[model samples]
Target chain A: MINYKTVNDNKCLVIEISEDFIIDNSDNIKLKDAINKIESLPEIAEIDFDTTALKSWDSSILTFLNHIKSHCLKHNIAFIKDSLPGGVQRLIALAEAVPERKGVRKTEVNRSYLASSVAAIGEKVVNFTKTSKDMLAFLGETTIAFARLITGRYKIRGSILMPIIRECSVDALPIVSLISCLVGLILAFVGAVQLVIFGAQIYVASLVGIAMIRVMGAVMAGVIMAGRTGAAFAAQLGTMEVNEEIDALKTLGISPVEFLVLPRVLALSIIMPLLCVYADLMGILGGMIVGVFMLDLNVMEYYNMTRDSVSLNSFWIGIFQSFVFGILVALAGCLRGMQCKRSASAVGEAATAAVVTGIVAIVVATAVITVLCNVMGI
Target chain B: MLWGFKHLDIKTASITLKNLTEREIGDIKVPPDLTVKNLPDSMKTPHIIVKNITMAYGDLVIQQNLDFTVNKGDIFIIMGGSGCGKSTLLRHLVGLQKPAKGDIIYNVLSKNSDLEQNRQKEINFWNTSAEEQRLLMKNFGILYQSGALWSSMTLAENIALPLEAYTDLSSSQIMELASLKLALVGLAGFEGYYPSEISGGMRKRAGLARAMALDPDFLFFDEPSAGLDPVSARLLDDLILELRQSFGSTIVVVTHELASMFAIGTNSVFLDPVTKTMIAHGDPKYLLESSKDERVINFLTRGEGKQIV
Candidate 1:
């Protein structure tokens, strides 16, 4: 364990960090508090992070030091870590990158953070593609396995289908419907707010009809499923992968794709359409809520406008897009699971990757389809 | 250890699968032609020769220049450190992974060749179809370290999974066979239970039952004793030895458990951590007692008191 303590000398304030700082979170907190105190005191000029008393410290304490540096920069106070250990120098350098007294705006900070996250996501996607060949093979093999499963041969009348429906489909409906309804209400309300300024409040019904049928329903369904079902699938398969059950299947000549991936892919592919249908209905219902209660528009008037605006082709296109999104989400989840490293942490990471990748795929697909339809004058 | 004991009663927490009667277990009597002890004598031409096979992930070389032969019916055990490529070697054997640099040649015998060729053909029939390969593997079973039973399936369903996939048996017949397997693994009455509902040891047993479902000729185990307490591990080790004696199947085990190594490995291969090479290969007792190799000596005699690196 490392400990750190700061002493106020006549010329300089000395901060002593105990070696047990690595094991002690309180030490870090105290260090931060001390830094905060020194920064607040106008008399203090140079602050020395006294690592002579330091025994051990993890990278986390370095981050806390970074916090201190930031605080010092805020106050135009110079922070010195001359006694800092070699291990924490890099962190200090990184934290010290920002100059003193030139703070970023909140929006700029958010955008920079967003940009870094996006870059990280891009790197992950590239990395995923490297391992994707094996995953593709696994998926192909799993597809074959699923086809075999559906041959009506492995019927023990066992409780397989119920779990699929309960866990993957039926259980997901209420939440899916609820989220879709909320999204619809928000969209309609936003449209109403904008159109009422132009004396076109009634056009909000048409906007809701077009958006729900073409974009919102499928996109929202895909995003939610990516968050919910996609994560579940990855977690399930990842747990199996970590447990070596997949290897057991391989050794038994039982293809994991057939045994594990197939069922999940099939379940997701089948359940996705249902989810989309539910989403579309609920979104329209939400629109109806806004139309009647919020927008002061009658329910029948809203329905008639929706009916006029939404064609069978429009509805079908949305449904078809959702179906594609479902497959992509399922594939992304399964791929992540298949690519999962043989560890518990790997499983968790794979599950998170599944959801993230699924949402990205959804956004890209939705954008492409929307653009394509606009170009074709649909 | 107390936590292990506390988990013993977990089997009764959920729905249990039906067990098969003693008479219903499928009888498979196959001779064990592949014992590691008889590798030099039995292998006229090595089926799979691993010579100086070096494998690494990034900067760390898991195994290097490994020299070994896997012949028909050879129950080979590869023992090493945690990340020492024991599992990687098994993956190579199963053709799931290619070595970093090594040749794995498979001898194909054609039917139209001469008399000697005919004999070779008789010894080895070639089939390219995946289904055919699967059918051949039907005679093999694999028990994983973590006892990878399917979470969704009941114990009975898990055991019966292979039969359903490859066989034409009715549900009743599959259940009966599955029960027999369950009984063999001491999971007779717990067939309907899901993997989540069962204890770890029971799940391992269940995995073993499922592995044996196809009546495989070769059985592969990866860290069979991992994550288990001494008592459960001992029970599992005993079970492994009993199966080896009774079934006479080719058992390839990848484990570093010294107790398990000494107990069941008739012949074993010692994988060195530093060299990433096979330091010794022979009977465990002989290698431990007679080998002058420092690594081998240190590895074999190192008691459980020393923590594994």
Candidate 2:
């Protein structure tokens, strides 16, 4: 809403700003146009501001005045600012108090695509090595903490262990049951499709039972726990880190690994084999449901077939894999949480990383256990 | 008449400026507890009155029976050691947290009411509805200790946010205002820089710039010099004084820093952590010199290398 009147007062150029000098883009355009006009005017030797009628102004007016101040300076014209308000004078004085440092402002540098790509790859490589080293060191710390825990030398509140065990077992049962059942049904359904072509549709029982007992139950339980319990563990510890609660523990002569990580790892490792056995039963029941209704098989016959298909070694192998998986998931979650940077965003990233790392560790462990069992003729 | 919604019958500080001259602010009859001798008389008006205030978080009471008058243009210090509820008191005053009991009345200059009658209409700031609380908050601004600048936004964008949300100013005008405010705090030409890109002291200055963007009648700073070197802290202190002089806004600072308490504080309340209540109330320097309370004397004289002058 700023309005200016240009008066050539014979000796100097007086641009009198009147009304509210609330400068926006329109005002900037007009001011630029005014500057252009002044450039064309050879008779104008000096620029003086006349703001006697100006009502109220803010930073926009300051920027406008600053613009004129610079214009006069660049053109070797004398600039007078006595007519402006006292606040305006003080403000303009403050703006020019410190000059901007040279080379302080960021000016983008041009680089070749090849150079940038190479640099990025080099940085990623360094990061990968550092991350692997850090992870190995964390594993060593966890092992020492576990050793101390086994010796009954940990500082963890003994009261916390019971609740954590309950969480990983009892609280996890319903979801584990639901997923295992659905997975069993899918396997039966898929096996029936192939077995019907050979007029041996009853072989679907053997397929579902053997798969659940040997590998599927443990893999499913591991993946579920990785997403469920692992994410929760990471989030809880990451938040504790952000709040400096973990630091408080450390300063109070308590090791974070022993007090926080040891119990979690132990609880999950102890409960996961039990959950896998429970999951194996649920998966077999699911296979029985499909066999009884869809395939027109009697309940007793399907049950007997499933019992014959599942051997002691196969069941034990699955339980062993689940036990290892429990350790891996808990370790991954706790490690990422403890390694978190002290920020809200870093806590979120830690939780996400924990889930990814937990699932990856589970898959790799499953592959190793399966190959060892196959090669050793278990 | 700032917001001018027929229901929102609020008069802003700017609208009621001329009426302040007629306000009987000079005759502040100091209660016995607040009387500290050898204090100068000036143009300070009672801005906020906290009477019989009890602040608590759920069941735990932080401070009790708090009664104090914060005057206009006064740099009031809420001084105490750690965990003494200084920040809690600030939160209560700013309406961020509700007091457990009693009233926080804003003393405003009534337009047509008599000077004495105007005291009756002093709005109860503590128990207002959410809408009215938001409007009432416009009279004051706060600079949190962390410099609570939105990390996602650049300094200019951060400063521009409140202006954009409240005012109908054009984007270009807002940007210009943002630059001017930044320059006022010696952050000229750094408008495009994000908070993470700036130094700690610069971020604090940027926060001060945002706090001053509204030119509120009152400003609250929570531990303004919590993490800064001596030179930066001194510069911040000087800048605060300059801001008070220029904007003429009453400042309420919650800090335990003795240097800042001595440097710019005009009035102060000493809250004792152990006593669980305010032990002293007056000018910081005056209390340091004349207070008879052992705890007050000890706290005020802590870490100073010499005896009281």
Candidate 3:
């Protein structure tokens, strides 16, 4: 609690602060009233602090006293700080030791929403162009490096290449298999339901086979690699960028792209088609399990129908799509990784961007390839 | 003093004795009348000669007209105010970034040859071929400010990577050497820990271990004492001193910490951000006592209120 009184025959204002003047009790104190009283009275020559009755205190009391001190300063009245505790006086002195720097605080600027939106859009367009130029340059460098490798001028150690291949292909097998198998089973079940309405449940074999071989199998593998391998590649390289390992490599006279990115891209390119083939076989097996057991079709009939429905043309196209997807995934992953800023959060954002870019590239490639195939009447 | 010589072996003591002046030997109350011509061969040779280099990022010049020589067995300190391109200067020396102007010449000798047979040969760093640059870089070990350990690799693997890349050492040999390097940095039994698994101090030690994996001729440290407690920083300084004493590797450090600067620095160059060039270059202690530049005196006697015009 705080109380004030006129002292020395109304010449001085004695402010008494007492009993737990902490943050919790700050709301109860009427600092405004005290300020108003000081302003109203012109005869008061000085203000004296009286905290002798205070049981305990904190910054709240210091702030209250500071407010009064500033008011006294403004009005040219004497603020006798001798009556306050030594700690309080020292703290006040310490707080005022250094003046606040100029122009440090940010002032809010009001602008129309349309003006702000247009500015933001212009900034985004500039950023997009810059990013595109960087990506094109990276692509050119990678291509030159790949050419160097082909001519046997650049030698990549087997130790680096082998591990990357194992990571993207062998280590990725279980996930790709699981996802592909489930996709095939869902397609078979859905196709089976419709076929049963026409008393043609046997055609479920053709439906599952053609779908899995033509596009679904490659698409599933592409999506899986995009999420799994692409994200991992981005995060790995992004973290390396953040740690200055890339700088270390450069100083060590090693090209970061050749030593790091090339191996990853080569591994994914070689492994994706192989993974797609494996995924296609697993997906067909999954459809067979449903057709033979649930649909009660003869195993031979289902097998023969699958063999007839899945043409070599479709098989080659599926392989071709997966190859394209592999390159796209690798490019997206490495692009994001190389573009990563030197920070922890940038690594996470790079990984997210890699996955987004990889999946979008896969979808767009799939759409274009399908349109081309339709135009060619294949 | 004799106390400083207590830990020195007889060979190093003799070397130290050859270089000691009357004042240095005065601490032991010894008469300095002996002729001193038997200095170590490395003492006279300059390891790196950074001649009039200008560092910049595009057109924004960080520092210009920098010239210094790092003698072998010298713990050279690139001392300066913050943002004065001290780290950038180290980067230029280490071949991470090329100077916009001027050349850095490295005086290297073949590893197996005797000192008499293989007099130091100068290799202009920037003008050398990629292969020659790689070979030159093999003899340099650098500790970055943030440790920069490969987060994906275990500490053991991080140290072993350089060994594996540059040496034909077998896996077992590489592992043993990696463990030995880790033990040297007082990080024994931490071989299995990844960079992210350890504390910042531990990671810095781990980075030091990796840098020393090849036992490079020159060691570059960018703020080795940063983000460390006073006690830890002191320990790091002692470790750096011990490494220099044991291996005789020429070390270059970039830092602003006065404590470590005074503790380990044998020679230094003070870069001034305002001037975009170095204002003082000499032994930091000597600079503190006798330098006429007010900025140098103010920097050395910071927080002591002893600013002299």
Candidate 4:
């Protein structure tokens, strides 16, 4: 028997197979409807497939269940496949015995395991604390060195500031602005499509406002900055390290981190906030166009909706996220720079690594923050 | 002075002595108006001291206990076989590596007379400060082995980089300085060219101009004539010598080319790639004559150039 029911205020569509059968062609149009209905109720709690009643299910049934679980999972629901019947349990055990699927789960387990292993490897082979201390010490020294540089204690003229600013800030503006507008347009289009179907066309403004101020603006700004600016920082410093320019700095009584990484980090940190603000304006404007033309909403109405929907707190939160992302980009860039080996190939590797690492960090941070804020009812 | 010398030797892990007494070493006479003290302020401090330095990267050892003094107004050279660690030793001097087993003391020379203050300033000056470091880097210039000028920058922009980064000079002033440096290097009116637009020799010259932009006192050159034709190499060697005479700057060059070595190396260090050690020091011709080391003899008297089959 396939017992399908709505649970937790229709927040979840639970499809339970609790019968002993092969479930051979299991063509049920009603099951598809049940799955579709789950999306209508956004308060999805849990999608529990208590397969304990299932005995000797067919391969197609397993496939359908897996597909359903994945879909529910995507909609932000917990897909729990609880206690299984003997035959089904035996089949699952046998599948786990297979090499490929076994390795898949193994890898899933191994990822977290490997992350923890870094601590172990760092502790056993390397002096974890000492290495950390040294890194921190290096950063500290770099900070002090940079402080001297700014105060002219090292006698560096105001002249050096211009090139760094030009390269790090001014040169980055065009790319940042262009990418922000595109991101805004994309998000607006997506939000308009969904809200239009519901005849809540004016809600497109609210969608764009909330999404841009909460996620897209800061995230896209960060990603763009990482690609354009972060990689540039890494490549610049990486090339210096490989070509001995960094060493030249050392020999000139200059700190490589202070002279190189500090300026980049500071320049990026200062610019990211402004970039986020620009991105927010562009994204909202993009949504405004979609709302006016496609969603049949007036531009003034859209603007008022956006203003009413998004709060300063949300704006601040987005900025905060972008600030964190900016710091991460710089940190990753600088980290890549310092880690670069002295070779031509190593410089390229560091640049690519900085971009990849920066993007990945941004995504993970966004997900975690979004989930955390949701849980906090913020 | 003796203790300091010991420390210096232990730190640099390498040395080059004239060995013929100070009188035998001929000094090139320059125009009296050019004083060594007027060299770029970048070289005021002894940022790095490489003494008796022995370097080995993996299995490739470049030099051992090689002693050399890189003082203000000194233009130094480390020349050897193709596999020799001239570049490696140069890398070591710049703190790319910790000496396998020696000291590479890096610090600015402080003008303050107090020992503690001097030490603090030296350490702090080298340790903390981004702006100062950039100016200092601007103060010193390097012509890379491949003339690794940024591909994105124009010739004028490339030359103007140091000036832009470290000087308050306006764009016009930067342009003037860049053009002047380019002219000095014999590449006038090539300001609009990119690295790809220029010939290899011109690129190297342009690189040299960039290095000279900050009016640096210490210049590090790696095989400045490596891939150039012999005529170009000779011209570069002449340029190196002229730079010394005109600027009174300290230059450290890494080259294995015999012609360039003899042409511009007033004092030199010879590294043996095989043993990863400095088997000879002093004038190139003297190392050829007075040294009992067979490697030195064979290297000096190989009769043919590196191109000989």
Leading candidate by lDDT: 3
**Order of quality (DockQ):** 3, 1, 4, 2
Listed for each candidate, the true contacts retained, as a fraction, are: 0.64, 0.00, 0.58, 0.24
lDDT sort, best first:
3, 2, 1, 4
Cα miss at A8, model 1 (Å)? 38
Over A1-378, each residue of candidate 3 has an lDDT whose tens digit, in order, gives 667789898999888888777776445346777888788888999998788888887887777778888889898999999988888889999999988768857987776999889988999998998888998999998998899889997778786789788999989999998999998899999999999999998899998888898898899999999999999999989988988988877765567888788888888888988998988988988898889889999989999999988899999999999999999998899889988998899999999999999999999999999999999999
The regions of model 1 sitting more than 4 angstroms off are A1-162, A194-202, A294-297, B1-52, B58-60, B70-75, B81-83, B103-137, B227-231, B303-309
TM-score of candidate 4 chain A against the true chain A = 0.60
Query: Where does the lowest 10-residue lDDT sum fall in candidate 2 chain B?
Result: B6-15
Say which prediction, candidate 1 or candidate 4, comes out ahead on DockQ. 1
Please write out the lDDT profile of model 2 over residues B1-309, one tens digit for every residue. 445763343344433543554244444453445546445445556788888799998898999988887877889999988888998898788776778998887765443454344432356875667445545566666787777665546899778866764578998999999999999989999999988899988988898888777777778898999898988898889989998998888899998788889999988998988678888888898888888787778888884423655
Strongest candidate by DockQ: 3
Instruction: List where candidate 2 sits over 4 angstroms from the true fold.
Output: A1-47, A52-59, A62-81, A85-119, A155-157, B1-255, B259-309
Candidate 4, B34-152: lDDT as tens digits: 01223353433343355456677766555677654454455566867786767777766544455666655433433345433332122222344655544444445788777776665
Total backbone clashes of model 4? 30
**For residue B4, what is the lDDT in candidate 2?**
73
Best by TM-score: 3
Q: Which 10 consecutive residues of model 4 chain A have the lowest summed lDDT? A: A101-110
Model 2: per-residue lDDT, tens digit, A37-64?
6787767777777788889878888887
